[model samples]
Target: MKLATYNVNGVNGRLDVLLRWLDEASPDVVCLQELKTPDARFPLKEIEKAGYGAVWQGQKSWNGVAILGRGRKPILTRRSLPGDPDDLHSRYIEAAVEGMVIGCLYLPNGNPSPGPKFDYKLEWFERLARHAAELLALDVPVVLAGDYNVIPTALDVYKPERWAEDALFRTEVRDAYKQIVDQGWTDAIRRLNPDARIYTFWDYVRNAYGRDAGLRLDHLLLSPSVAGRLRSAGVDRHVRGWQHTSDHAPVWVELSDD
Candidate 1:
C-alpha cells in the first residue's frame, strides 16, 4: 500500500493543488493535517468525489487532522489523543485502513520557546509516547504519520546551529522523538534512505524553497509488522513550489501488501 502524509495548511485555500496531487499520487491512504476548518465546513463531498473516504477531527482556524482511505471508509478510532481531557486542539485522529491502524497528527508548533508553549509541547510529547506505547502493544500493523513539528536531527534541518533556539529543533523535542523510536518504531523515510538530505517542509519566507532550505519535520513511523513491508519512501518536493502551496510538501512511503 502507498501511504502519504501532508500538512495542507488550509484545506479551503489549497483545495485545487491538493486535489491535483491526490489524483496524481493516488496513494491508498493519506493522513492530512492543518485543515484549519470546522468539521461542518470540511468539504466532505468534494473529497468523496475524489474517490477517498475520510474520518476527520476539525476545529475552527487551527490544528485539524484526518485520514483518507481509497475505496474504503476509514473507521474513526479516536478524535482526540488520550490523557488530556481539556486539550481542545484538533491535533490527532486515528483510523483503521486496510488492516493498519493509522494515526494522523499535527503536533504543536511551540514557537518562541522557553515558555508555556514549549512546556506544553513537551507535555504533549509525553502523552503521545504513552498512546504510542499502547498501540505498540497491539502488535498489529500500525502507521503514525504526520507533521510532528520536530526536526529529529541536525541533518534534518538546513542550519542546525541557527535553529538551536527554535522549538522545532530544540534538544528536548529531539529527545522525545528519540524515545518514541527507541520503543521499537521505525522511522520509515530515514530507514529507507539514511545519510541523504530529504526534507518535507520549507519556509515561505526567505525564498527557502528556491534555495532548498528546508526541514524534515513530517514523517511516517511504522510498527515492526508494517516496517517489515516498507518498500520505498520519498518527499514530493516539487509540490512545495506549486501555486498557493503550503509550506509543507507531501511525504510518502510504499509497503508490500499485508
Candidate 2:
C-alpha cells in the first residue's frame, strides 16, 4: 500500500495542484494538512470526482486536517486531539482505512519563540505525546503522518546554526519530538533512507527551492506492526516546483501487505 501526507497550505487555492498530484501519484491513502478552509467549503465533490473519498476537519484561514482513501471512504475515528477541551483548532484528524489507523496532523508553527505561542506549541507537543503513547499501547498497525512543523535534527535543516534559535529547531521542540519517537515509533523516511539529506519543505523567499535550501518538516511515523511492512519512502520534490504550489511537498511510504 502507498500512503502519503501533504500540507496543501490552502485546499481551495491549490486544488488544481492537489488533483494533478493525486492523478500522478495515485497513493492508496493520503493525509492532508493546512486546508485553511472551513468545513462547509471542503470541496468534497471535486475530491470525490478525483476517485477518492475523504473526511476532513477544517478551520477558516488557518489550520485543518483530512484523510483520503482511494476508492473507499475513510471511516471517521477522531476529529481533535484529546488533551485539551477548549483547544478547538482543526489540526488533528484520524481515520480507519485499508485495515490500519491513520492519524493526520498539522502541528503549530510557533514562530518568534520565547513567547506564549512557543509555550502553546510545547504544551501541544506534550498532549500529542500522551495521546501517541495511548496509540502505541493499542499495538495496531498505524501511521501518523503530517506536517510536524518541527525540524527534528540538525541534518533536517539546510543551515543548523541559522535556525538554532527558531521555534521549529529549538532544543525544547526537538526534545519533544524525540520523546514521541522514543515510544517505539519508526520514522519511516529516515528508516529507509538513513543518511540521505532528504527535505520536504522549502520557503518561497530567497529562491530557497532553486538553491536547494529545504527542511524535512513533514514526517510519517509507523507503529511496530506497520513499520515491519515499510518497503520504501520518499518525497515528491518536483511537486514543490509546480505553479502556485505549497511550500511543502508530498512525503510518502510504501508498505507491504504482509
Candidate 3:
C-alpha cells in the first residue's frame, strides 16, 4: 500500500495540478493540507471523478486538510486537534483507511518569531504531543503524516543557521518533534534514506527550486506496527517543477501488507 501527503496550497486554484498528480501517482491513500477553501466549496465532485473518496476539514482563505482513499472512503475519526475547544483552524484530521489510522495535520506556521503566533504554535505543539501520546497508547497501527511545519534537524534543512530564528526551525519546535519521535514512532523517509538530503518543500522565491534549496517540513511518522511495514519512501520532487504547482511536493511511504 502507498500513502502520500501533500500541502495543496489551494485546492480550488490548483485542482488541475492535483488531478493530474492523482492520475500519475495513484497512491492508495493521500492526505492533503492547505486547501485554502471553505467546506462548502471543496470540489467534492471533481475529486470523486478522479476515482477517490475524500473527507475534508476546510476553512475560508486559509488552512484546510483532507484524506483521500482510492476506491474507498476513509472512516472519519477526528476533525480537529482534541485539546482546545475554541481552536477552529482546519489543520488536523484523522481517519481509518487501508487498515491503518492516519493523522493528517497542517501544523501552524508561526512566523515572525517571539510573538503571539509563535506562542500559539508552541501551544498547538503541546496539544498535539498530549494527543499523540494517547494515540501511541492505542497500540494500533497508525501513521501520522503531513506538513508538520517543523524542520526536524540540520539534515532536513538546506541552511540550518539561516533558519535558527525561524519558528519552523526553532529549537523548541525541533524539540517538540523529537519528543513525538521519542514516543517510538519511526520517521519513515529519514529511516529509509538515512544518508540522503531529502526535502519536500521549497519556497517559491529566490530560485530555491533551481538551486535545490529546500526543507523537509512534511513527514510520515509510523507507529511500531506500521513502521515494520514501511518498504519505501521518497519525495515527489519533480512535481514541484510543474506549472501552477504548490511549493510543497508530495512525500510518500510504501508499506507491505502485514
Please give the CA lDDT of all the candidate structures. Answer: 0.93, 0.95, 0.95
lDDT of 3 by residue, 1-258 (tens): 999999999999999999999999999999999999999999899999999999999999999999999999999999999999999999999999977899999999999899999999999999998988899999899999999999999999999999999999999999999999999999999999888998899999999999999999999999999999899999999999999999999999999988
* Model 2 per-residue lDDT at 53: 99
**Residue-by-residue lDDT tens digits, candidate 2, 105-164:** 999988889999899999999999998999999988888999999999888999999998
Each prediction's TM-score versus the true structure: 0.99, 0.99, 0.99
Candidate 3's C-alpha runs over 4 A off are none
For model 1, the run of ten residues with the poorest summed lDDT: 103-112
- Candidate 1 structure quality by residue, lDDT tens digits, 126-194: 999999999999888899999999999988999899999999999999999999999999999999889
lDDT of 2: 0.95
Any runs in candidate 2 off by more than 4 Å, and if so which?
A: none
- What is the lDDT, from 0 to 100, of the residue 40 in candidate 3? 98
Compare candidates 1 and 2 on lDDT and give the better one.
2
